[model samples]
Target: MRYVSLGSGSKGNATLLEHQGRSLLIDCGFSRKTLLQRLELARADAGQLEAVLVTHEHGDHAKGALALCEALDIPLYCSQGTAIKMDWTEHARWRSLTGGDLTRVAGMSVAAVTVPHDAREPLQFVVEAAGLRVGVLSDLGSLTPHVIAAYQGCHGLQLEANHDPEMLRKGPYPPGLQARVAGPYGHLSNAQCAELIRRIDWPGVQYLTAGHISEKNNHPDLVGQALALAFGSTSRPVHLLAQDQVADWCEF
Candidate 1:
């Protein structure tokens, strides 16, 4: 299996997970044009995409899902709460998945795990194929036992390191925005991210990608330091996602 980040940041975020000759899009935060261009760059034809699995109704996570799914004649799989919030009932290409429900598609099995975020019924995912598992987790607040269980033993994982508390406290944003970011329903702090990684079981993971970074309150250096604390060393391979361009495929 392979995963490619179309982009990852506050501006937009999308990822393509491909396995067994089938391509599945995890999210569609980008505009149609941008996502299609990134798909081409990743060597995945947009016309051949199997489905769009939405995590939440946030614009940076799923703003483009319905349009892309409609354009490509594919299904949009998401929770009932997310569907209700989106209010896109027409055309009837929806696949409703409840929390903790497991479904198989394109030779890969996907399980939805609920997440604590400022959404109606947000969810993250774990995809398993050919004895390997990969977790896609982001836009979450505090990590819970369920999150740890869902993300454990991943062959490849994408985790969010959204910001540094110190930087955010001193950044340009107002007090309310800062409070929202630091709240339990907001993004995770650097320390929280590092600690969560240390708590998970991921010995055989080939790649660990940090994503959904704050352009203002975080830096690559901070993310590296946090990762070092998580692994207790600097020898482990890690990839940092960006908002401007698509990332190369990380295969496992």
Candidate 2:
């Protein structure tokens, strides 16, 4: 299996995963033109997308989903709440998915995992194909036991380390905004991310990509350092997905 991140941050987010002659996009937050360009960088064709999976209805994650699926004539999968939250009557192909059910999309086995987020029915995904497993986890405020179990044996992981707690506390965000971000239903902090990594079974996680970093409140170095401590002396490679640059393709 192979994967690449088109981009990851508060601005937007998308990921491309391919294996066993099938390709899938985890999110489609970029513009159609930018999405095409990023796919081209990975030598992938947008017309070949098997499915588009949405985690939530947040603009940075769901903004371009309809446009991309409509343009490619591909099916979109998300929770009923998410579908209802969308202007789905305007689109023809959409499938509502519930957590814990396994579905095949473009030859890949996709299992949706519920996540705690501000959205009504947000979900993360665990994808398996060609004897490899990839976990896509983001936009969650906290990790549930179900989330940890879902990602227990992933070969490649794109996990969120959205911000630094201290930075968030001392940063310039207003009181209400800060409360929302630091609340139980907000994004994860660097320390929380590191603790989660420490608890997970990491033997199968050969590649780790920290994603959805805060451009204003967190530094890539902080994320790297925290993860490095959690992954001390382990051979696994940890990468930070940039907000602008597309991550290099990695295979497992």
Candidate 3:
């Protein structure tokens, strides 16, 4: 299995995960042109994409989904609530998935797990292919027991380390916005992500990628520190996906 992040941040986000000759995109936050260019860079033909999975209806995640699907003529998969929020009923190729249900598309098995977030129906995905499991988790305020269970034993993981609590508190966001971000329904803090990592079974995680960092509130060094602490004295490799540049292919 191999995965690459086209980009990750508030500006835009997209991730490509592939295995056994099948490819899937986790989000379509980039412009159509930008997405196409990144796909080419990864040596992927846009028409070969098996499916596009949406985590939520947020602009930075779902903004370009419809356009991408329309252009590529690919099927889109998302929670029923998220479909409604995206008004995907109007699109013929959109498919609705409920949390806890397993579905197959293009020979890939995908399972959605519900997460705490402000979106209509938000979910993180655990995808299986070629006897390998890859988990894509982001935009969650906190991790739940269900999340831990779903993400356990993943061979690769794209986990969000969205912000630093102190940086956010002292940063430039307004009081209300700050409250929302630090609230139980907003993004995860650096410490929260570290705690979640400690709870998960990590021996099977061959690749760990930190994503969705806040440009104003969090730095790559802060996220690296937190993860290093959680993965102390371990030889497992970690990569911080850049918000502006595409990440190199991670193959296993």
TM-scores of the candidates are 0.96, 0.96, 0.96
lDDT of 2 by residue, 127-174 (tens): 998778998898888878888888888888889999898898889999
* Residue range with the least summed lDDT across 10 consecutive positions in model 1: 229-238
* Predicted candidate 3 versus true structure: per-residue lDDT over 75-166, tens digit per residue: 99888888888888768879888899798866778898899988998988888887898888888887788888888888888898999999
The alpha-carbon RMSD values of the candidates against the true structure, listed in the order shown, are: 1.2, 1.3, 1.2
Error at 156, model 3, angstroms: 0.4
lDDT of 3 at 65: 84
Model 2 lDDT on a 0 to 1 scale: 0.86
Q: Could you give candidate 1's per-residue lDDT for residues 1-252 as a string of tens digits?
A: 888899999988998888878888898998878899889888887766899999999999889998898888899998888988999644498999888999996778999999898898998899989888889999888988888878888988888999999999999999999988888889988788888888884568777888998999999889978887786555566688999878989887
Model 1 scores a TM of: 0.96
Better of 1 and 3 by lDDT: 1
Candidate 2 clashes between residue pairs 3 or more apart in a chain or in different chains: none
